[model samples]
Target: MTSNDIRFDCQHRGDGGPLVIVPRIDGTPLTELVDGFEIAAGMQPAGDAYGGLIPEFFRFGPMQDHFLGRSTNTMGPKTPVLGCECGEWGCWPLMARITATADFVTWDAFEQPHRKARDYVAFGPFQFDRHQYDDALQALSAEIGSNVDDTRA
Candidate 1:
């Protein structure tokens, strides 16, 4: 796959729990890429924080709009692209500026919320075709949504 090509996969925790929606760019998991960058930079990678967001938080709605560059969270124009392994996004988050246009969507300016000194300037400015990116999001969201067991009374 090209550098711009992005794919979404569900990562089962093998504990009979919820599934996480992981993003793979050019066949490399995003968490690995970030951790590799940290290692190359002589910094300790935040292993516990290197994980994809829970499917519930990644469903198509405000989260999708955030990724599409249509909305922003408390981080201003940046949004949390990944969260902690414990499933608490606010505990540890990898934020990035997502820019979308009619033709393309780009993610850049990555920052670890708890590490202000860490420079992620060399990490990414990964761009993807808008059509493909949107399609991937919708498909993943649908899959997760369908499998959700909402037992609220």
Candidate 2:
């Protein structure tokens, strides 16, 4: 199947797990993502794990800087640490499949869990509520203990 074949329909459950990264595929016995959706030290999906899988709905690149600079509402303030090969297109193309809904300590990624990062913007410790983050972290922790590796997916 193609990347488009994988639906981008992530959700943010306020009272659910700290964080979840589900990769669902249609009509296959192996489609259930629960096993695949293990939590990890960091929110890998939003991190470098999924190759910028979801919308970095936190910043604007060149296209945005020119037009939607003001209305643009992702993470912005600019930093070389949070650099992107995509450049001004820090987040773009409005990818339709990898739908992601995050429950952040704050609406801005530039904040929390981030300040902990040596380079806050490019990459850093993603901070979230302990209760929520722990729950998700536990699941991911289990995965690490397991023999299977979903990162290969």
Candidate 2: where are CA atoms >4 Å away? 1-128, 148-153
User: Candidate 1 on 12-107: residue-level lDDT in tens?
Assistant: 566656777678888888888887788779877545457787745544344467567564344577877777777776777888888888888899
**Residue-wise C-alpha lDDT for candidate 2, range 1-153, written one tens digit per residue:** 111122112333245311222322342111122113212224333332221112233333322121212324443442221222242223422111111235332112332222243222432222334345334435434543341233334
Best-fitting candidate, scored by lDDT: 1
Q: C-alpha displacement of 8 in model 2, angstroms?
A: 15
Residue 83 C-alpha lDDT in model 2: 25
Candidate 1: 10-residue stretch with minimal lDDT: 144-153
Question: Each model's TM-score?
Answer: 0.83, 0.21
* Cα error, candidate 1, residue 142 (Å): 1.6
> How many times do residue backbones clash in model 1?
0
With a 3 Å backbone cut-off (N, CA, C), the pairs that clash in candidate 1 are none
